[model samples]
Target: MAKNNGDGKLHVAMLPWLAFGHLIPYLELAKLMATKGHKISFISTPKNIHRLPPIPKTLTPFINFIKIDLPKVKDLPENAESTKDLPFNKVKYLKIANDGLQKPIQDFLKTSSPNWIIYDFATYWLGSLASELGIRTAFFSVFPAVMLGFLGPPNVLIHGDPDNNDNDNTIIIKRPKWVSFETQVRPSLYQLTRWGHYNSDGENMSDVYRLGATVDGCDAVFVRSSFEFEPDWLNLVKRLYKKPVIPVGFLPSTSDTKDDDININNNDSSWLVTKQWLDKQEKGSVVYIAFGSEAKPSQYELTQLALGIELCGLPFYWVLIDQRGASDEEVIKLPIGFEERMCGRGVVCREWAPQFKILSHDSVGGLLIHSGMSSVIQGFQLGKPLVLLPFSAEQDLNATYLVEKKLACMVPRDVDGSFEPESLADSLSLVIVKEEGNMYRDKAKEMMSLFGNRDIQDQCLDELLHFLSTSIK
Candidate 1:
């Protein structure tokens, strides 16, 4: 329970999805609100809450961690509370378990009497539940604004047109009449089929419907984007959703300071070792490669990526999380003599590495990654040019935006969503080794000023606070 300041300060309950990608941004927003003298109840399952980055000691007074047990489902594995714990095929089971949280969450809202509930797409039921309890609800989207615009109106997304026959072969997205800008964010047939399968729970509502209902039912929509980056797309979302669409600027971690300011001794030995390796590399010569937590690359794809990295012949640091069922000895089977051949040029870390620390390193000039929004923001914040190898639909859309904006280069992929080693090597070279790469480097640097602007982010926070205050009253 939050202690009210007696100054009409709002108490906000933050309810994000099971995925860390979604939970982290919600937690960042909660921290921002807490900094503004608001009370925050950061709600999540026990395991998910346990995995969150440490909250600053200063914020402990204003923020409370409320854990609710995740309901068990028959198909979901034990202790699998988030997307990172499961393969892509098992993600739907996580969502099914998430739906079970509604009753416990509703019970909390009834007793807590918070002024507002900030929720994610999967928790659409929270909107109506909050409303029933006389609480305001806001949908905080961790995705880019362009994705919502591309998805079109709630009605359209819920009931897509039967006449439309768009498939994977289409290079350009079929834009709605309201969307004035040209979009190259095309979803492949394979990705769409996977999406369909994920949503094919018998008689249960699809993710699109749930998301649409959440947006339609909420008081306002908050996106983890900046107005400067996607003005047209953001404007289109406002028109399509017919709600107050607020851009909260990329919700970067406030603790992200320069390496010099950080106490290296406080970091673990692995981080120190990685940093030492990075320190040995020349400035702007190393490529930092990570595909985020959720993307599980097939062994074939992993091998292709390894070969591509070798082909590029550049100093690289690759973070590869071990396969779920792989043995310790067979965790990462690289090409024979590959490590020996590339000694001093590449390092493959088979465990979690501090991504922000690596990204902010002076030696890292380029990023090879799946275009998750958090990764995208982190990459742009440090002005690192990108080599995008998107592994999912949202990532593909993000990659398209980066390519269209001239901030990154996307590796050419087959219609089946597979990429050849040669293509990956070429894209990496184009972004890192080629003379023309400077344009991307310059663009990334230019955008850093806007994307990483703390002042603008504070202003956005002010706007959000003002909205919550005025609307709640």
Candidate 2:
């Protein structure tokens, strides 16, 4: 059994990658630890920190937001601190800037000297830093454990494919020789190539290299997954990494606070209009569409998507972000007369929408979204079936997993990984209107037995806390 300190309090420092997908889970863990009487220092750049969800007032005292200055890079745009602020190619610059934080973070560690430092995969340097300060380090992965298992050990990932000559054909993904069971999570050759390119040669170290080092160096590893959902993969991760691989349960948003209360109190007109529109829709009739924060679709893709939604001929609420900065023309141009054709049945929101509230609404029966892990958890939590359109970075893997598990249906894409309007419409209809989708609906609801079990999740957290407490001594 693990032993807690005399006062049963531990000081922990959290460091997550700059993306919201990475940052949010780290914050959730910090909040969970805070509720257990731990003091946490959450570190990030200023702009990224400013964008985090509002921390509950009661827990504010125990959690400290520490800001580090982002180093200036020539190609990286000014004030672009997070992945959300940059286009796909420019993301490497953000990583370079993040690597520059080593000295500042090292300095902070020397002074604060926390018992344990919980970090994300990108910060491979953190393990050495924690060692120098006589503190323990734990790696908290926001991605699913199954995806990690498919990638296999770090040596295989970094050194296995050294020739780079495997680009001529589609590589079939299958169960590694080390693993016993077959996995459904497979990436196409194009997806793998893009991934390889992103993490390949860079001014600083590559992400793949960093991930290998972090896994080898950390004291323990924690993944945002559950045994009920992925027992085999969880077991394989421990065997592959040769470390304590802990599952921390899917971190769902605990805030049930209604946005209507705040909207009504503040007299916000736009939200009132949107909420009233949602109220009028028939139960389980509307499809909620959002492609996630980081995916920037081209104008042609956006136009095709609009047409596809129109062709589906269902009531839909779509959230599209405006990426054209200071331009006079619209960022996403819908097919001409689209609004006039489907005025009452469709609503488009260019600004931020309350995603949780919309997902929880009675009118929402299904989701049309990118295969983000966070979105997957939310949809599963609400028992909403998915029409998946994956864009980049582990999303294809997520889509494959959901489809194989019968929890969702994926939109068909071309050999080059591009989707057409017809295929998009067909996927939407299959999930929302066709009889074939019922199995997905049933399987998604069945997941509630595990995904909604608060007791199991609490037990997992307790085990994690115990590990943290004991690892210090």
Candidate 3:
């Protein structure tokens, strides 16, 4: 794969995880890289490849898609459409896929090797195999600096202590004393307990450990965040990694794309209709509500949320992905007359929506969100303030990062992973009707200017191409 520099192009490969959140960023990163005249190959399972929207064939002339097969596993559902429909959560599927892709990767490397491979956390387990084949691999962490701190090697080594898993909502984690000036030592006991649940069963604990081990072996590590939001921990991570730890800002570009060509746009003509409705609203008045692809609120909580929106009496658009696996009759149990009440004021849609476009819309002033990283990035980049209702996973940490750091406001959650209506109403009132709301909106705009630059993509692409082509002396 070592072509002469006179040709003036580099070759790179991208392997994203099965989840949509992971896949979207990798696609954006690939697009950015391809803009710099690099040859790109994207590897994924066939099912996921087909799920991608069709891009302009001209824009991706140098790109190719490679599909790898996974072996049959018992008790797994057949013909699972997407990661959401998989029999197990992402962690379990990651391990199985890592083991399954080993042979295919080896064969591909022997025949046609790319200069470098960029991968996500789920595929970290393949680093050693890549190294054994004399290929360099880089790891891209898609979470905030603090969550990355909790997931990085240092935390993993000390995190297994029994006291770390206490049931209290807060845990005090002590960092190196010298770093105390810029850093405050804190551990989220609630988050740890939740992560324990996230990692339990099917050797999930071992898989996370494997993930940390893979990070340790990376040629370089790039986190998709900037130092402005996390000055202290960013410095701490640099010291910890002691390698080329680059802060490439948020890797997703918010530039307007040709959405008419996207495959996911085929369904739900209502989304476009809603866009027209949103355009008619007053600027900075409409609330954009979405709970992400995986977060399915129970009928009870869904009712409360709906009623809360009705009570707030704000113009809003909500993407309610019904994951109850219930029939239409059974789905009627949520909120009494809630749908009928918010009918004109709200536009409620099912399953999928064109989220990026919705977030970027001029009429979207605030977001009622679950704080998933992808949604968080979308909101942050779009300069939209947030009213957080974290469902599960790293969302707790993410919500805390946004609210505690003055990026967004948090709505209350219950002990059983549910939300309340009155509290949500209060949060909405504060974010929408109060002076503090304006302050948050202004801060979000400033942060957006820092992280959501169109130029960072070009810079990242340039660096990646340099790393791929220039031999380290």
Candidate 4:
């Protein structure tokens, strides 16, 4: 049998996917558990674990990071960080991850075992195996509660038909009997851009199969959201999963600032400097534009964004990631003299930036984003107004939910699937100078307050510990 820490403090293990979006939140949860006197073992591949900044020696007393070697796979991309970066599909990634988990985790359990494991979506394959070994498992879904509500019920995932074939239009909304079209649609706007995957037929089949396989034989499924946000959906999910379905809110109760000097190799430090710059600017004067790591716009959209920022005439910071159209041999080729004209007025980081710190900066009045949930949650948490530009995947749904719900404004993606300079500028103007902008900013603040104030973390921690204690006993 797996052994506990022996202090009545739950011994918790964490296993997240390779993606930054997945890794950051799970790490935050691990930090929270460690603060609650729980012993933690954060498991990841050596490449991934080494990417983390070192926690100060002071916080080292509570947590341990366990690194295991990734199995040898041929023709894998060099410097592959997460499953997202792999050349294969999500299904393929899960299969390999499941194979990888069996041996290392089994060996870990045979040695120093954890009472409970707070695992990510990709780790679902290990559920039955973990249970067989006498360790309890809980699933931590990084997506919103509503997505969980939709995906949680095995029937909806298995039996339901998508609303449309267009990845942009496949919005199959299941509202609470109490919510009206307006309120439900309102809440759905911010979610639309993020849930873009539901719009595509390809995603529907793959996601359904993957989620069903993952949720099977798991102990509990916890969503990172709140009851107030979607009480009816949460109830629906509970009925469907027939397991403990809980919403743990956005932020945890406590976070230990470990890894003070941990540097993400390709991440840029200019963002921190921008934070200082924003601190000096007038409140709400600057706009922050960032498409998450996956978005790779064609050369046309790149020019359009540049033109839009130029037309908006706002002091802005645009941190670009994974802009793949340009090769290593060719530098970023801007419109003629675009840099000279916009010099000092704009900043673009081809590398990753410190997003949370930038959003929290006082001068950052608004954000232009691809509606990734992590970015959306953080943006909302910081009370910054948003202009959503959803690409593919869940981002389209998230953006839709935020905008349709009046939490943000949508800068509709281009025909080729990008944001144009004109629409981009219009959206920016509406949010910053238009009457609608004022409303969005105010509503964003309200949402931020709700997310920040809800003691979701404490509730989650308490429930997780309870489950661990019961299982170990």
- Measured by TM-score, how close is model 4 to the native structure? 0.82
Q: Which candidate achieves the best lDDT against the true structure?
A: 1
Ranking of predictions according to lDDT: 1, 2, 3, 4
Q: How well does candidate 1 score on lDDT at residue 328?
A: 19
Query: Which ranges of candidate 4 are over 4 A from the true structure?
Result: 3-5, 83-99, 155-207, 252-262, 265-272, 298-300, 323-336, 414-419, 454-456, 471-473
CA lDDT, every model vs. true structure: 0.80, 0.79, 0.67, 0.66
When 2 and 3 are scored with lDDT, the better candidate is: 2
Taking all chains together, the TM-score of candidate 2 against the true structure is 0.92
lDDT of model 2, residue 217 = 80
Per-residue C-alpha lDDT of model 3 across residues 217-328, encoded as one tens digit per residue: 7777777777666776677677766667666567754444423212353564766787888888888788888876556665677788887888787888888766522221
lDDT score of model 3?
0.67
**Cα-based lDDT at residue 27, candidate 1:** 80
Candidate 3 total steric clashes: 0
- lDDT, candidate 2, residue 44? 99
Each prediction's TM-score against the native? 0.92, 0.92, 0.86, 0.82
Model 4, span 1-473: residue lDDT tens: 56666577877888877665677677777766676778889888777787775554655787888987766544344455455354223324333544566788778866776777777766546687788778878888888755565444554454444443353333554453333223333224334443433333432234555566567667888787777666656776777688887666675222334122124674555656776677677778788888765554446667887898899988887776433322222234568888789777777766556666667678888988877776777777778888877654456556655665678888865344555687888989889767857898898899776666636657766876676677674
**lDDT tens string, model 1, 308-347?**
9898878999877656422112344677888888888988
